[model samples]
Target chain A: MTEQLVLNYSIAGDDFTKAGEAAADFKTVLKKTGVPPDIIRRAAICMYEGEINMVIHADGGDAEIIIGADKIEIILADRGPGIPDIELAMQEGYTTAPENIRSLGFGAGMGLPNMKRYSDGFDIKSAPGVGTTVKMTIMLPKNRE
Target chain B: MKIREISEILGAEVLCCHELLDTDVHSACGCDLMSDVLAFVKDQSVLLTGLVNLQSIRTADMMDMKCIVFVRGKKPDDAMLNLAVERGIVLLSSPLRMYIACGRLYSAGLAGMSEE
Candidate 1:
């Protein structure tokens, strides 16, 4: 059978108020595609976390969502100061975000962790000064890990 | 317990979704960090935090939570209230701090999701 549909988005990093716009739109797309609530939730968590990363670190980037029959894949690519230490960044409590970001309910260093936790597939590629890109996938039913 | 019961327990004033006061939330979590909320919370329970911002309501909506109780007399602004109304979530403000409010609810049998 042919794939259901594909969704693409470009996130804006200019304003913090609009950080979740793309993710929220992705969520709407998922809802319209007949994804279950729990699966939609998994997708939402991953996309929102990635969206936040794009805003907080990358100053904005692009997100492409490929919604297939078996799974949904969200590839988020950003050009920001890449992580010097992926290991430390993956740690639960580690965060380099400024104090002001913490006031906004982010910078908890849990973004990547939560993304990994909610996603069936999580992979990250980064270079210290180049940029960072994260790919997270959520599978439905038997497609899930 | 129901959201209304919890509101009464904390003497909190409902800021939005007054109609949802009867919604049942069996668990509660207290945290100022939205990251911790994402890392730990589950099952659409109540969120107790002192953080006053749009992200707080957004976090609750993302978690599929039923209600948010702002402790330490933290009052939410118009943006936050508007978001709560849009999401159909119960938003309340309590004069109690984070620890005391969570403790009171815990002692009254509102268990954490992880504890169960």
Candidate 2:
């Protein structure tokens, strides 16, 4: 963790078209850094889902990713309305996104679940009136390191 | 199946990356929902969709899909096509609907991951 390469990105709220730009950029960086393909895919998927969630639910947010030799860590903080119930949000088929978002190919309630599915470690903290922060880590296989 | 074969079968026009026509892909999925495409699809190299947006291309990029077939004659904007070229993804537009395109490819031996 001491010699981590840290990258930061600002996510604009309600910008559906630009939602996944940050994650795409991060994936390119990871590819250039010679991360294993599978590891890169997992990190990219998790980050992309997080990016979409930030656009759909939080209006926008910020993402900080630390790339280490053994593990990659992500911290996404959003100023949008916080989730009142993390448990309900994590359910596989539960979503609070509106119909408009659904037509854009999301809001089936799979974002948070898919994020967790791809990451090795996941944490979510939120207060209704306050904002939300999501932390995730994906560990690289030793042989690939 | 090669991307060219998919194109011929679906009567799709190559919008970009024509040089990649020889690329061989084993599986494909047809859906308008990008999130569903992301969550449920695994190792599918071709995407058949009616949705027209940058997100479709972005989802294909994240999944490392080799080709995208825009069913129902949907056309991506210049920005999307530019991004596809940069990412080396083949873009195709077809007059066929999603169901028919998928059926054609499936009958021609392009498989998809089982939901189970």
Best by TM-score: 2
Which regions of candidate 2 are displaced past 4 Å?
A143-145
Give the worst 10-residue stretch by lDDT in candidate 2 chain B: B35-44
What lDDT score goes with residue A130 in model 2? Answer: 85
Q: How much is the lDDT of residue A8 in candidate 1?
A: 82
Q: Candidate 1: where is the Cα deviation over 4 Å?
A: A1-3, A142-145
lDDT, candidate 2, A93-114, per-residue tens: 8998999988888898889998
Candidate DockQ scores, in order: 0.64, 0.80
lDDT of 2 by residue, B42-73 (tens): 78899898888888999999999999999999
Best by lDDT: 2
lDDT of 1 by residue, B14-73 (tens): 888999999888888888888788776468489999888877887787778889999988
Per-residue error (Å), model 2, residue B30: 0.8
* Least accurate 10 contiguous residues by lDDT in model 1 chain A: A136-145
Q: Name the lDDT value of residue B15 in candidate 1.
A: 87
Q: How close is candidate 1 to the true structure, as a TM-score?
A: 0.91
